[model samples]
Target: MSFASHHNASEKGEFDKPSRKKPMFPVNDRLRAYLKHHGREVKLPVAYRDLQRFTYSVPLKDKDGKDSLWETVVYDLKEWEFIREGLVKIYAILKTEGDLTFTKHLDVARIDYCAFGNSQPFRIRIVNKFNDNYDHYYIKIADASRVYGLELEHILSPNRITFLTHQQTLVEEHIPGIPGDIFIKTYLQDKETNRIRLAKEFVKFNERCFVRLLGDMRSYNFVVDITPDIEDFQYRIRAIDFDQQSYEGRKNLYLPQFFKENYPLVALTLEYLNKDSIEQYQTEERTMMAFRLASARYRMKELLDIMGKDNISTPEKIGQLSKELSDYHLKNPGLLRCHSMGQLVKQHLKVCLRKNLLLIPRLQSRFED
Candidate 1:
């Protein structure tokens, strides 16, 4: 399980031949070795907890090559920030040979400072390191910055603190938002109007996310603010945690199913896929028609930008959405075996409107005389 061994040997257990093989990026291994060699140089306490057991940190250097207290902490997702008092943090998966996925880094860290935004909430500050290991993998801070911009624009970025890179560590701004479940039970259901407002926002949000290609959305990753504003006494919905976002490619629009149990709208969306490949656009537009049921304009472009795509051509969007819907059903028979996604969507709304009591009867009535 040593880094050197893994890097030197192929998966088949034979040593890689230089003539036919390319030297893999020495990112993780180099950092580990560097940290092992120079732990004392940066005055990193030897007895401290192994926050990143497999990770390594080295002192950052300036143009003049002088060691600075600042250093990048190279570690795996297995060991990011774990404990947060009230802030959310962002991190990148320093992918070497595959598509990079973004995620939140949850670790116990020393808080530096905080700020308050009336619209969003709390913002916390944290230290930043150079993250040279990430640089070695070509996962530059610029990519992270772009992704951050996308999240903010889409309103899918965590309301947490902003993450900034210093010489050796990352400084982050903290964000504060109620957990999804709590927000649902406490705020969403507090009043009929609140629930309706949330549902409207939810539908708009999903449609927007799908058309724009910001897959990997699910419940609990977001929160709703039911607390009425000082002037209007109305509720609001805000999305958070936009780490896993991409536009050029997508497994499916409903990729967030891993987190969500099942829903008719999502099932219908899946059913529209053609061959389990990228979703077709028309199918997505159709699914959106069912999802929105009433709204005509869905703001597809805005969402696409947040998803890092400049435009979703009418033809391309229709094509991808259709393909995705067709393929999704083939991949998930359970979704297709049951009622059509359209029917289920209708039932869900009825259930919501009837206060979750008439759901079964309504579903039975669809088939019964």
Candidate 2:
């Protein structure tokens, strides 16, 4: 199907789910250098390929005994010992800067592999032998698109991202939150749940994703982090999956409000937030993201330069997105000239956050190198 048709459907208040599988883009030399310069490249004791030695697997079930779309993988005895010891060390590297003094008391509790996505990550559960407490981390193949998404999330979003790349392996710390699908199913109508606050957060999240050109934020792709407030409650929606970053051509793909999976959240937004209030939250988020851009302008420039020269998407998608974005920002000539997803993102940032950039005093266009 053509992207124009997809855009038309999106305009008619419908959404088409992104492709079932997005081909993995390898981490090129330039991105590898960027990761190295930014301390995101680390040699780990275990790699993604090593963990594929699982001998057998059992379907993993949730607390309600429903299929969790994951499998508990078992390995040979010797291989298990090797992976357990290595994974414990990896956990330390991710959480405690490679500290091993607590290693003797820690053990790999289980290894669960999910074959559902492009990365097909192995979820590692690490437990402290003494306390019976466990923590989780992930190991996956390092794809360039995901790396760009992670780097952008670290720089632009309010949250801090911690991960490392080693050759074809990627390691990430667990992000704790209720999955958006589960949150909506279980918490949307709860008596104590603050609908207004959540609706406000959804507005901000929508702005964040659109401004940065991040895509595929269906309900399950993101999470809800709730915190206690003195008088009420606060909500923060965070994107958990980065597989679709900068890959789609349709502009609506980057906006969470258009996805059918997010219709409930959209209903909350429309029900609780007036048009002006929604605009206020969008501007507020863009202003904060602009501040973040200023703070990390140098690093963002480096990444954008590398990304502009990378081939993370097809030529057709690139051309379609360029035309769509150019149409969206007719006043900004740069969008018309964007030849790659990275360039579109760079210009889109300027178009969306120009007001906040002006407030930063001499911060505009400093990203040009």
What's each prediction's TM-score?
Answer: 0.33, 0.95
Candidate 2, 90-144: lDDT as tens digits = 9989988898988999998889999998889999999999999998999999999
TM-score for candidate 1: 0.33
lDDT (tens digit, per residue) of candidate 1 on 11-58: 344421111111111113223232234221122111112322435555
Q: State the local distance difference test value for candidate 2.
A: 0.88
For all candidates in order, the CA lDDT equals 0.32, 0.88
Which residue ranges in model 1 land beyond 4 Å of their true spot? 1-163, 166-172, 227-233, 247-369
Taking all chains together, the TM-score of candidate 2 against the true structure is 0.95
Best by TM-score: 2
Worst 10 residues of 1 by lDDT: 112-121
